[model samples]
Target: MLWLLMTTGKCNLVCDYCGGSFPRDVVSWSVKYDISKLKSTIETRDRSPTVIFYGGEPLMNPKFIMKTMDSLNATRWGVQTNGTAVRMLPESYWKRMNVALLSIDGREQITDKHRGKGIYKRVVENASYLKSLGVETIARMAVTMDSDIYEEVKHLVELGVFDKIHWQLNVIWSERWDFENWAEKSYLPGLEKLMDIFMQNLSQGILIKIIPFLGVISAHFTGGYRGSPCGAGYSSITVTPEGRVLSCPIAVREKWAELGTVNEFRLLEDPLPDYCKTCDVKKYCGGRCLYASNEKYWGEEGFQLVDSVTKKYLRMVISKLPEIEKLIDEGVISKSSLIYDPVQDSTEVIP
Candidate 1:
């Protein structure tokens, strides 16, 4: 099981597309979490748990995070950071962290435009520092209409820092948000460019990766359950500051998305909804984001748009598998570098 501790929902930066909201159930950041309840929750689980520190910016509650590491003695831990405030952590903390996912959208112009002044520089520096500390630092990009994935990835490659790169399409929770138009104009093109670059880089011995593409390919080979697009509420669950267990980090504020509390936890292991059963791309998509598919964002047109895009992405990556095999055979890329365990919610490298 993967336990996501939302240390604090207090982020220092507010980007344009962000909902800029936290779970209403959270207590103030000053109040320390009930670590006893958390410890008890972990003790009940049958399998060894993997811990992920999430935000607003998890580093806001540095003491709590450090103490969690001490009490749990968890080595399989990661942090989803905004790339600022990492400098506040001690050497011991950095050494203990296995993965640090630094959020950087693109180049300075693109990242700074959304995140704020000098963010790109700070994040890049932090990513480099994390690498020096031997933590696997991945550049997590939120792809939007304005994003240029190819150029952005190229920039990261030039910086010679990040150990890997992963991206997710920006989710617009507002009913008024026009994702359809954006998908047509920007999202699809950027993804195609990114796919091309991803393969080209691998052939040339660069290990950068686009996570979703890898996830789809991993599912294809592993015969793993691709249900729900992720492990939310199943293998992975998030806990808020107030002790509410939720499906995912983004689903924290969503009222219907709540599972249960730390003490009285519930895992809704329901299969795919009826509407998704007969879709051609069902296995590849595994059902779109469970929280998004709920009534708030579901409409026939919108559903179809997302479905088509998912299928397109799957097909594009599938077509390139032959080339990936070729690269592996030619010794351009190592087979060990590509790994996927669907149940683990992992499509990462050994590094």
Candidate 2:
């Protein structure tokens, strides 16, 4: 299981979607835990567990991060950060890092519109630096209504710094947000063009890994459930700085859903809902983000919203699988390229 440790509730960037907070929960709470307790808690694990460092900005507490890294016996370590504070980390830290997910919304204008002015420049610079250090930096984007997925993806491909890119559609947090309609109108069309380029790039031995496409395709080939859309409490769990353990980072802001404390942490015991039993697409989707599965957060159509996106990509994957298979047969792309490694949280590609 992956453990998410929220170091603090502080962030330097005030992105439109994030509201300038780390982990951007529905309700905001921030507390700093005892470093020794956090360290000992991680050390007590009998088996090597992969731990992910999260925060308002994890690097804001450099001392805590380094201390925990020194104390833990992690099989792999991951960090989700805004990318600006990378320089503050030690050279040894960068070398030891397994994966780093850096936030960047496609191109400069699109990224800066949501994140602050000049923030894109800072992140790009940091991404380049990470690349120079041989750090596996993955670019992450929060696709918004205005985002041109094709253009943004092209921009990311052209940047030539990121090893891969993963993205999520902006959560339908506002009641007025018509996410299903947005998927039909805005997302799918752009995805078509993006997939066209994706296949072409693969043929040319350049792999541009988009999460939804890679994720469903990996599930299809591997013949396994994706667990849940976001893998909330099953594959991973989150710990608040105050020692509260929750299913997801967003779940910590929720008062009614507290699973347990750090010492008493319990994995999600609930099975897939009854709706999933009847749904035809459960194999591909598993069930989307648990927190967004509500009527209040994503509207009564929330589940449908999740289904629409998953179905769109699943269809794309089905259509292209033969070609991908052909490429593998021709030794253009490795069969391993279609596999998804959850421990590393990355899609592999041999070019």
Candidate 3:
């Protein structure tokens, strides 16, 4: 089981897409429950669970992170941060972390446009610093309207600091953008080019950790059926600062997302909807996203719009499977390189 521990709901940066810190009412700025209660709850459920520190920006409460790490006997420790507060936690503590995901949306111009000026530089520097400490650093991108997926991913891959690169589309929650237009004009085309780059890297015996491709391809070969790629309500669950357990971390205020509390954590039996079960691509895409599937914040038309992109993206990857297999057979790339183990790392494989 994967435990997403919300260290705090306070975020230092207010990005255009996420709209900054989570409201205090929705997710409290600080943890209120006793750490022992969380320890007991986790221990009772899974013996060697993987605990990932999550938040509006988890680094805001470094003390909580340190304390929780000290308390729990977790199998692995990871954190999803904006990269600004990496210094708050000491090197010794960071050395213990299994993974650290830093949010940086591709290139400097695109990243700065969404997440303020100087954020790109700071995130890259912090990623390098974390990499230096032998931490498995991931460059996590929130793909937005202005993002050129291919260029940004290529740029980050060239940086050589991150061990993996993952991205989630900004389709859920906010309805400010013209997603339809952006998908057709920018995103889809860039995705095709990105696929080309991914294939080229594979042909050259370099398996670039472009998560979306690796995840679906891995599922295709392994026949692994997942309800949600991130395991929101299935293999993983979130513990908010207020001790409220949520199926998905971003589904903070939604009543449907509320599973239970820290005192008594209960997992949802059938989290994915019926439509997803009937969908042909469910096995590969894994319902895309649990929150988006349930809430449909973008409405039916908008939801389908995102679904179209997902379907197209899936086809693009599946179409290249024969070539990928051929490369593996010819020793161009190893077959084991396609195996992606970070299913519960909030990589959002479908995006």
The candidate scoring highest on lDDT is 3
lDDT of 1: 0.72
Residue-pair clashes per prediction, in order, are: 0, 1, 0
RMSD of each: 3.3, 3.5, 1.4
Could you give the candidate ranking by TM-score, starting with the highest? Answer: 3, 2, 1
Worst 10 residues of 2 by lDDT: 342-351
> Weakest 10 consecutive residues, lDDT, candidate 1?
342-351
User: lDDT per residue, candidate 3, 1-351, as tens digits?
Assistant: 889989888999999888889889988999999999998888888977989999999999999999998888988889999998899998999999989999999999999999999999999999999988988999999888888888899899999998889998888678757988988888889989989988888889988898888898898778755678788877889999999999899889889888889998678787667777887777787788888888888788889888888999898889998998899899988878788755446577887
lDDT of each: 0.72, 0.72, 0.87
**Residue 247 miss distance in model 1 (angstroms):** 1.0
Query: Per-residue alpha-carbon lDDT of model 1 for 89-149, expressed as tens digits?
Result: 7878889888888989878988888888999999988988989999888787776666766
- Model 2: lDDT of residue 341: 53
Which is the winner by TM-score between candidate 2 and candidate 3? Answer: 3
What is the per-residue lDDT of model 2 for residues 168-284, given as tens digits with 9 covering 90 to 100? 777655434666677777778888988898889899776677666676667667774544645566667778777787776766567545668766666666635556666666666
Q: How far is candidate 3 from the true structure (C-alpha RMSD, Å)?
A: 1.4
Task: Count backbone overlaps in model 3.
Answer: 0
TM-score of 3: 0.96
